[model samples]
Target: MASARLERGVVVGARLLVAAVFVAAAVPKILDPAGFAAAIRNYQAFPYWSWNGLAVGVPMLEVVGALALLSGWKRQAGALLLGGLTLAFVALITSVIVRGIDIGCGCFGQSEAAESVGWPLLVRDLGLLAAIVVAAREPGPLRAARVR
Candidate 1:
């Protein structure tokens, strides 16, 4: 019984930690929509007009996902969305690395930085991907083990 309780606590802690990271990342983009648009443009992921839409929309979705995870509301859906988002980010960063594109990650920044793409960014996203996958799959001991 004690061991199960400990495991449940650990799982919840992991989910909270991942949720917190997403929330923190969203704050800066929320503060400067225009800057985030420019950052999205820097990725060259979409057409000119679409960049603005993506800039505005992506962060908002992220905020929603973060809130869902934090609140443990519709946790399974939230975790799935978070996992999908993390996978998309991983793919984007991988493409940038492959194409030898030296640009600011702009993940935390509203605008580009005067730095080059490197292994660290990929590594970070990979870590997040792992966390998202774990959270999605497990959804914590308490939630999973409870009577349905």
Candidate 2:
């Protein structure tokens, strides 16, 4: 039916948009790991030594997830992971905001404003979550493996 085609088109568009956002975000952090480490430090969440680890690990995960989303490979798993990450971010940011701890979001590295957990951040995370949820709801294009 025409309606089915329209729905599929919408889903595909949403997937691409979400993948693009993650890819864009990952590039900056990947390009400047040291800067991103500094941004993590600004967040004041972890110990001094852990910032570097997070800076490296976080971006790697983001890049992988972004690629998976873009490729439509293991789509269900990738979308679920992304959705969980977004939920965690939303929770973390909300907690920081409630505690009145103003600091950089460190989302894509440090911002000139030292991006705090503000309304815009919340909205962005929520949007990402919604997109991931939509992606997960669709049937994955990947083939299933047999356990034997």
Find the candidate with the highest TM-score and give its number. Answer: 1
What do the candidate models score in CA lDDT, each in turn? 0.75, 0.76
lDDT of 1 at 148: 35
Which portions of model 1 miss their true places by more than 4 Å?
A: 111-116, 137-148
**Clash totals for all models, in order?**
0, 0
> Tens digits of per-residue lDDT for model 2 on 1-148?
4555566666787888888887777788888899899877766667998988988988777777767776878777778767777787898788777778777787876657556677789998998888877765563232121221
Error of 1 at 7 (Å): 2.1
**Candidate 1 weakest ten by summed lDDT:** 109-118
**lDDT of candidate 1 over 1-112, digit per residue (tens):** 5666786666677687788888877888788878878777777766898987877777777878878876878877887788788888888888888888777876875444
Cand. 1 Cα-lDDT:
0.75
Estimate the lDDT of model 2.
0.76
Could you tell me the lDDT of residue 48 within candidate 2? 99
Clashing pairs in 2: none
- The best candidate by lDDT is 2
